[model samples]
Target: MSREYKNVISQIFKYLAISLVFMVFGFFVGQRFIPQEYIYYANRIIAILGVLFVLLAIFSRKRIIPSRFSMNYVYLFTFIDGILMYPLFQYYLYDLGIGLFVSIVLGTAVLFGVLSMVSSRKSGGYYLGLGNILFAGLVGLLVLGLINIFFGGARFNLVISAISLLIFTGYILYDISLIKYSVENRFIKDKNDLSIHVLNLYLDFINILLNLLNIASYLDD
Candidate 1:
């Protein structure tokens, strides 16, 4: 990799590590520092903000996030998303204890590492071509997730989470491939591009991590 490309990748890894720390810190805040009801609402608030931040970051070129905005907010939303995920992780921890949490994190780390390495290679075009299929699967998963929210069936949730895990695994591979392609083609022109791409990888990582934790926790419960 070129030095610039290597620097970009290193920045991505650095941001991801920092984001994970924020998540763990959020967990501590939720479990100890804050009241349960407050943390409950805080999670919702952060989730909404997370979406808005992502959208704003995407549309920054149009003056939504603004050119003057710092990259800190991009990372902040990542931290917020981590906070938003705290409850789900806590629930799983309750279900399966600390061991499962550790295993899930380890497994996700390994999977992400392998996928990122492979996807960063010059031969990563195959994952890039799956854009349409991946979108279709995500939409289907969204519909199924909504249905489960209303119906509350164990079977439906299991299936949904399983499918979600697969989708996010695909996402990780595809997203990393996109990063490699964008960097090589000189498509990542500004901080906006960097922030958005990092956010994409962060989303892929968290989805797989959360879903893996959920699935294993359910089985263990």
Candidate 2:
């Protein structure tokens, strides 16, 4: 990769690592004060913010404009996503059955790794197409998840969540790698683009971790 790409990747990872640290901290802190239902709402709000950040990133890149809108939105979204997902996971921890949860988590991780490798091989319109696919998948999974919560079995919900988590994680890694490669190739002219990459990765990490937490909670139960 080129130096610019390296710089973007570096920033993305840096922000991701920082967000993880804060997530852990917030998880502990939230345990003390927040209720479970409210936490779920908070998670949804963060999800919305994440969606918005991604939109800004895409728009800024297309319009040849740059803004800190990406970074701030991602940072806030990741933090809140983590905070809210924690309680939900805790709530379901005992019911998920440990053996099954472990299997699911491992499977999801492997799937993410594979998808990342595949996405890395293509570019240009491929990235845009992939992004659209990802967005659609997320929406579809979200609907299924909500349905499972109200009308389906716990096992069904867990399964859907695990798949969703893996896809989102793949997106996070893919987006980070793209940004890095773009910067290195001089494809991204604006520095703000770097911020967009960072935000995308951060959100990806948040979603992945939250899904993992939920899986863990299910296993514990």
Which one wins on lDDT? 1
Candidate 1 segments whose C-alpha is farther than 4 A from its true place: 33-70, 124-126
**What clash count goes with each model?**
0, 9
Q: Which candidate gets the maximum TM-score versus the true structure? A: 1
What digit string (tens of lDDT, one per residue) describes model 1 on residues 1-221? 56767777787778667766776776666566444555334323423433343344235323444433355765677666556556656666666779877888899999999988877765535478877777777666656655555564555666766787787788778877777777778777766566656666666777677667656755875
- What TM-score does prediction 1 earn? 0.80
Residues 1-221 of candidate 2 have per-residue lDDT tens digits of 34554555556567766766666666666777776566445334434433444454345434444444555555565566556556554543434555664565466556545655565555523454466667666666656655654565547656765876766765754574566456545676654555666655555554565567555655665
Whole-model lDDT per candidate:
0.64, 0.57
| Per-residue lDDT value at 195 in model 1 | 66
Cα lDDT over the full model 1: 0.64
Where is model 2 more than 4 Å wrong at Cα?
35-73, 89-128, 184-191, 213-221
